[model samples]
Target: MNIKPLFDRVVVESVQSEEKTKSGFILPSSAQEKPQTARVVAVGPGGVVDGKDVTMEVKIGDVVLYAKYSGSEFKVDGKEFTILRQSDILAIVE
Candidate 1:
């Protein structure tokens, strides 16, 4: 299945979080923090939104940081994804 976002919305897949600490101590699944970073799966076309000219700055395959509690989560073909507005994305990782 494929996802195509609309109106400046973005679809992203969460990147796997590190399971080990800097000291090489392995952390349990329950102890691992939820990854704040995600890989862009789809991007909405830039258009007028909320009466403003919104431009999309992120593209597919880009890694980005986003607000922790934003967006709606769902699953497609057994994989999880999050859909959010472009404004919720903080920064694109180089």
Candidate 2:
């Protein structure tokens, strides 16, 4: 499905958490931790600030780091998605 964000909001697809440990020990899905990383899917044009428009620092396809509990979850085309404000994104990864 086609999705678009508005006014500094961003849509993201969560990166799945690893199913195994660094040592190659497999972990059950119930024991796995939620992922804090995500890929930007859609981004809003900008946010209003002091009557002026403040452009977002992130763009579509940017990988970003966010707080574990920062966004709201939803599903699109049977795939899970997250909606969050720009402030919730911690950093953009290279």
Candidate 3:
């Protein structure tokens, strides 16, 4: 299935978090932190939003960082994804 966002909304899939720490200590799933990074799946067209002009800075396949508890999460075709406004995305990963 394909996802298409609208009105400055973006669809992103969460990147898998590392199971081991930098020190080589393995962490259990319950103890691992939720990943804040995600890969852009779909991007909305930039336009006026909330009485202001909004421009999308990220594109599909771009990796980005977002707020810890922002956006709405859902699943499609057994794959999990998050949909959020472009402003909700903090920074695009280089």
Backbone clash total, candidate 2: 0
Which candidate has the top score in TM-score? 1
Query: Over the stretch 1-94, how does candidate 3's per-residue lDDT look in tens digits?
Result: 7777888999999999999999999999999887899999999997989999998899999999999898999999999999998888999999
Q: Best candidate, lDDT-wise?
A: 1
Looking at candidate 3, the ten consecutive residues that score lowest on lDDT are 1-10
The whole-model lDDT of each prediction reads: 0.94, 0.89, 0.92
Error of 3 at 14 (Å): 1.0
TM-score of each: 0.93, 0.89, 0.92
Better of 1 and 3 by lDDT: 1
Instruction: Write down the TM-score for model 1.
Output: 0.93
Q: Which stretches of candidate 1 lie over 4 Å from their true place?
A: none
lDDT, model 3: 0.92
- The window of 10 residues in a row where model 2 has the poorest summed lDDT is 46-55
TM-score between model 2 and native: 0.89
- Residue 69's lDDT within candidate 2 is 91
Arranged by lDDT with the best first, the candidates are 1, 3, 2
Residue 54 of model 1: what lDDT? 98
